[model samples]
Target: DAGVTQSPTHLIKTRGQQVTLRCSPKSGHDTVSWYQQALGQGPQFIFQYYEEEERQRGNFPDRFSGHQFPNYSSELNVNALLLGDSALYLCASSPQRGWDNEQFFGPGTRLTVL
Candidate 1:
């Protein structure tokens, strides 16, 4: 059994660059959500994916996108990145089932844009 895992732990890029972050869900989890947390701010919902389809999205621009695999893994993609996009990208997983599903978060991937 494994907890949620995210790739690259950290990343650095320049403005206008593109970045892709990956996430592997915890065992028994079926839904994955992506969040962005800027310095000193709480995590803001970016979007959520389930069953390979986007289920919900936040007020972010079209540059944000995501994909969920049949194995419950997911990826978060951001295009035309801006300095304002620099933040900790978190991946959370929960069972897309009946009530009482608890979400578990992974160590976030820190993005630094110059």
Candidate 2:
């Protein structure tokens, strides 16, 4: 069975630009989480979407936003991008939102901002 998948494996943007990254959840999954991983750093949780609503978020600024579609796919939108935004954006999907639920992650979308 196909697992979570992301698009635009690589991307480049300039400061103050906006970018949107896509994610398709694994079959039978209904929750999606977004994370940003800087070089040599662990993935930092951005936010999570469930039932098409923003369920939880981390310390990320308001520039980071996301949406969950009826099909369980998602899109992460970053506005007014900064050089610090350069990182690998990861998407993870799980059957449900809970600490016990196992999440499957996509390879990731690398975003570089100049």
Query: TM-score for every candidate vs. truth?
Result: 0.96, 0.97
In candidate 2, what are the lDDT values of residues 1-114, reduced to their tens digit? 999999989999999999999999999899999999999999999999999999999999999999999999999999999999999999999988475877899999999999
Top-scoring candidate (lDDT):
2
For all predictions, the C-alpha RMSD in Å is: 0.9, 1.1
Whole-model Cα lDDT of every candidate shown, in order: 0.94, 0.96
**Model 1 agreement with the true structure over 1-114: per-residue lDDT tens digits:** 889999989999999999999999999889999999999999999999988999999999999998988899999999999999999999999988863766899999999999
| CA deviation > 4 Å runs, candidate 1 | none
TM-score of 1: 0.96
- Which regions of candidate 2 fall more than 4 Å away from where they truly are? 97-99
10 residues in a row with least lDDT, candidate 2: 94-103
Q: Report lDDT (Cα) of residue 47, candidate 1.
A: 95
Q: Which ten residues in a row have the lowest lDDT in candidate 1?
A: 94-103
